[model samples]
Target: MPTGVAIRDPREQLFNAAERVLLRDGPSALTSRAVTTEAGCAKGVLHRHFTDFDAFLAELVRDRIARLDATALLTSAGSGVVSHHLTVALTDLFGSVAVAIVSLVISRDELRARLRRTTPTGIPLLTEAAAMLGSYLAVERELGRIDAGCDLHVLATTLIGAAHMLFADRTGTPPDGTAVRRVVDSVIVGALSTPPR
Candidate 1:
């Protein structure tokens, strides 16, 4: 009963459906039949778009990672201390996105290869996050809000990794907000503190 205008790009629709399935029931529920059924399309529609179920899953994961990177880019622009923005930004990154990544990483060899191929060799997300943290600290130092002469890059990496572990809770709910704030602020202060040389 679907006409050209009524029908969306099946590939796009399929990917969106897969994301919902992933968020709801996790990745194991993402078979071609399940995706097609969820998308309300023919089962053959999957194959018509992706090479196989694994390829489709890998593409889904790739699309998510790209979206996360785009989010970090737009959100980080003109943002303040990693304390405020980092937690929420990282909540998005290390939260659902990280879970999806771990799922794909644990899947079959070809899927793993596809993920690796889609991802750049280095983890630019971490690097960019750290750079952003450094910039924030550098600005604070200039403003007399904090002392300087600190290695912002190193501190940024530490904060990024720490944020991942701290906030990537398996439980649906996040941990205490104030506690997270203290941890992030402490790390920033400790790293950027102006100490006598």
Candidate 2:
């Protein structure tokens, strides 16, 4: 077997490798052999850890969602310009890696079913992202950065929906960080009233 990092967690290593493959080569290039090679592990290593490729993918998606959730929580807690923080969070989610995974899951029925089985109660990443943004907006509202009467859930969904479209666009060059920030800022400005002078 090939050797690589001395990390204790094989699953994490595999997940990281899989993510690299997805981002660098796109979803079609992702395979058990590719992941194991990227991780510098034996071909059977992935099977040893996960039931199969679909199960592994489901776990990977869940892990990424959990990471995004953590980021949202941290951003909400940090002291900074609310719009900047939100822009950063949404941009993170709209990266190539995320877009690739989301595209793969949507087009693959087996993987989608596996994911649904894995996460029964909670929403998928997109819905979860909207909820995270909504939670952050609620925090901003409490801090008087958002309008008191604004519908946070709707605002969050709208922002996420718009960002999703931009991220999922493949015909032209994807929006860069600055463009994403501008979109996020516009959403925030529209949702918030002017602060009392």
Candidate 3:
């Protein structure tokens, strides 16, 4: 890299590089050098864009969280099988770099603290996931798909936790769709007022 080579969207490039590093070599291999090298930019590029490496990581997680398609989930409330939608969502989320991102968050205290400033609650990815699922469940409840008195918060948490466990097994390939659907069905069974369609 040259001294004055302008890199378009350095932040995104750096974030993508970090994601590649995190996904390929795990959190332990991720560093300012690793990210900059992967981005094909100078180390100063990262420092100039972010307050620090942790700041970069925090922004990465936030970027990923922002990418989750809440609108699709929300709009699916009145139509498709709830479990099916959740199954696809969970599978897509964990199948990507999300599980690795979760690991990265857990490995770095500074990143966690920085994220806490914005996410002030549970783990970033999982917390937002639960909220997404919870929002979908709330819509379902209104549509009479689930029991009127169902506790959506609890249901959403259960679904996310259970689904996360199924996909967190990075030791092997992510669980197949059937496996995810099973977890979804088991967790949401008690609350369903109407049969899954």
Candidate with best lDDT: 3
Candidate 3, residue 123: CA error in Å? 0.4
Q: In model 2, what lDDT does residue 88 have?
A: 78
Q: Which stretches of candidate 3 lie over 4 Å from their true place?
A: 1-4
Cα RMSDs, all models: 4.8, 3.7, 1.6
Query: Candidate 3 lDDT, tens digit per residue, 22-128?
Result: 88899999999999999998899999989988888999999999998888878788887888988988888788888999999999999999999889998998999
- Residue 139 alpha-carbon offset, candidate 2, angstroms: 1.0
Off by over 4 Å in 2: 1-7, 69-80, 118-123, 169-174, 195-197
Cα error, candidate 1, residue 79 (Å):
6.5
lDDT, candidate 2, 1-197, per-residue tens: 84644558999999999988887777888999999999988877889889999899899888987877545555564366776777778887776467777877876778888778655543368777888888888887887778889999889988888888888864458788778777877777866655221
lDDT of 1: 0.63
**What is the lDDT for 120 in model 1?**
49
lDDT of 1 by residue, 1-197 (tens): 75423446887899888777766667666678888878888877889878888888777766655554444433543445545665565555665556555554565566777666645443434444556556665665566545456676776687777776675454456556666666667677665344211
Scored against the true structure, residue 189 in model 1 reaches a CA lDDT of 61
Q: Clashes in candidate 1: how many?
A: 0
Q: Candidate 2: minimum summed lDDT over ten consecutive residues — where?
A: 69-78
Clash statistics: count for each candidate: 0, 0, 0
